[model samples]
Target: MVFSWIRKKAADDQEKLKKGDELVIPNQFVCPISLDLMKDPVSLSSGITYDRDSIESWLDGGNFTCPVTNQVLRSFDQIPNHSLRKMIQDWGVANRSYGVDRIPTPKVPVSGIQVSELLFILEDSVESLNGRRCLELVQKVKKWGGESERNRLCVVANGAITVFSAAFDAFARDDSFETNANLLEEMLSNMNWMFPLSQLHSLDHHHTEAAQARLGSRDSLRCLVWLLKCGDLSAKKDSMIALKELVSSDQKHAEALAAIEEASEVLFRLVKDPVCPAITRSSLMVIFHLVSSPSSSTSMAIRSELVKMGLVSLLLELTVDSERSTSEAALGVFDMLCDCEEGKEEAYRNALTFPVLVKKILRVSELATQFSVSAIWKLGRHEKEREKVNIFLAEALQVGIFQKLVLLLQLGCGSVTKEKATELLKTMNPCRPELECVDSVDFKNLKRSF
Candidate 1:
């Protein structure tokens, strides 16, 4: 009779659970990233627990910091929280009467030994069967690596780069081989995942040079350019990202890439594409990085092409329409471009350039402000046309450039920037005396120091 009564009570509990009853979950069982009961809980070096898949996705996206603590992760390793997993499973079992499902154990992640063996299979054999197997392994590694930082590091540490490079070289060498665009795209994605920007500076010099050589090859360069023009959206983004990494790692690589005529044109097109803001911003950044090294042959080449491609008008437009980072990148590129005669001519000829420059001062971040001021100073110093200079000065006055400059001085800017601003103010003052009293007190104080 007692047993029957217990069974009846259990049935009643299950019935209530099925009737839209709310279940209270313990806080400890929740993953930080998913905010759900962790089916496969893992702990990061930050000592925070998250669902395995959620945390892995976060790390694989090139983020090296702990999401919760915002601290630099000491390691990319994720240790499985077996105790937490078991506890959650136990809770589910205890609540079975309430219709709660028990959590199943997750499969073990790909190991370094397996990755190394597959890499050997790729490198040591040339049979068609081996090639097929190798491609399969590459895809698996990519999938596993994308799920967790540990797998990514393991794949990279196991010489996956060399394996991918070999495959790319083999395919490029033999046009008759069935070239799988998808496979190539996957390889590029994995390469990007392995070598993010943060890891570039730490690479050995030889490694950087080798990468430059491999990527700068005619066949390799052609493939990348083709991918940009014809590949799927994912392929194009990955190609651009890889190109960015290459160019940012060393000046030699930038020069080599700029030497490719098709590359410059493709980058320009990417900049103009409105469909992807992320791609547009990245494209601008690549161009900025390319032209950053002044007095280099590469810089001269890139600047010439930029002018030929109507970069001035585009940059001016982007400055108005883009967000803060994109605006800053545009201004940064403009600053470099204006250093040369051709770039200055293009900028000065544009009616909007000077006005835009004046308005951006004190209107954006300090970096943007600095670039804008420098651009204006460049125009003012280089303008041999007396009438044009007068017109520019008029525009400057009308746009409250003087007030902003005075405010900039009082607020304190870089020494060189302040000197240039002061020089510009002094130059323009002779033409506009009525505006002299605008910030007379602060202006006098700043002038005395100068």
Candidate 2:
């Protein structure tokens, strides 16, 4: 009779839960991520849990809506409060000692296993197998029924961790050249994991220190490539952050610069990475602000580094990047380039650099032409810098930039222009020896005598 009453009460509660009246998820099973029950069927933090594998299978089975929210859950990541991972080891140990049957009832079944990642570490014996033999082994694992397969997968997963750690150690060792690449490549080819196992295997100070030690070194190239190919923005940025820290060390600067160059090369491919957007825009902003400030070590270092990396052209290219911040930064970078005599000389020496500015000025004649005229006037102000200015100015004028400036002048006449541009034109009076093309009539009325 007592058992019958318990059954009746359980049925009533289950019915209540089905209607969404429950405050907490029934502790029938714990979530792997949170190690908690399906409480509130909430997000990753609510300590709620769900049958992720079940949910995944359900989605595969065409059930698209959440059982609780009735809202369409996009993917497992969207399923409310995730299971806390740290609880898993404790739960597993408790279950093993207490016996799974007698373990205190968890909100969910405290299965002593998880599927966060999979690594396939082939033994020397396994590697010796022909392709056909390997395929046969894979088939057997696939066919192995639930519990047995999970156990084998876990063992392999653990072995994979060992192999990955060893491979990273080998990469650190000077003699492991072929072996490191082979092991890393083999691991990548077979494992479902996204990044190198060492990065994902753990987040201890040891790994952090190892990563730091590699910064600005040839080995750093591999890390950069790996991060670019598989890391999230956070990871990529973290690597860059480490690279940034090492830039202060003179001993590491060379390596750091190489790493930055490597990172910059890969940056274009990561435009979609939400974590680290192109430093190009930020760099442009810095260039703009730096140009306005007086000389400083910080500004000098940044300018030197950017110049070394051939980033000036890249910054100029951002004038066309779809982002306004990037375009503005590009404009600012151009402004900075013209601000310094040494930089102006460098730009003048590079003929290719002049065309883009010339083209921009020609297309957006008013804005581009005005900015160029201002820059030219600034350069012209410094008597000592006149030769460099003249060389660049001659190129600009030859490209018909003069014609575009003339158009802007015609438009500005309506706006009562009173500035460097007006002063510059007056100084270079139309009828002068250098202004041979100025016609007689207009030249006489626009004479400097007025």
Best by lDDT: 1
The global C-alpha lDDT for each of the candidates, from Candidate 1 onward, is 0.75, 0.44
147-214 in candidate 2: lDDT tens per residue?
A: 34334344344444343333333343443334333333333233323223234444454543443344
lDDT agreement of model 1 with the native: 0.75
Q: Tell me, what's the RMSD of every candidate?
A: 8.1, 16.0
Q: Mark the regions of model 2 whose C-alpha exceeds 4 Å error after superposition.
A: 1-231, 234-279, 286-292, 316-325, 362-373, 379-382, 409-418, 427-450
TM-score of each: 0.73, 0.34
Model 1 misplaced regions, further than 4 Å: 1-90, 93-104, 125-134, 169-178, 197-209, 383-386, 434-450
Error of 2 at 23 (Å): 35
Instruction: Report the C-alpha lDDT of model 1 over 1-450, residue by residue, as the tens digit.
Output: 664564445435543444456666666777777887789888989999999888988987999999999999999888998867776776688777666787888766878788888777776643353456656767787788877676777777666665675565555444332366666777788787766634655346555556556665666666776788778789888888877777777667677677766878888888876548777877887888788788897788888888879988889988986789889888988898887778888886888896688767766678998999998888787657667767777777766688778788978789889998999889887766554324233233332222
> Which RMSD does model 1 reach against the true structure?
8.1
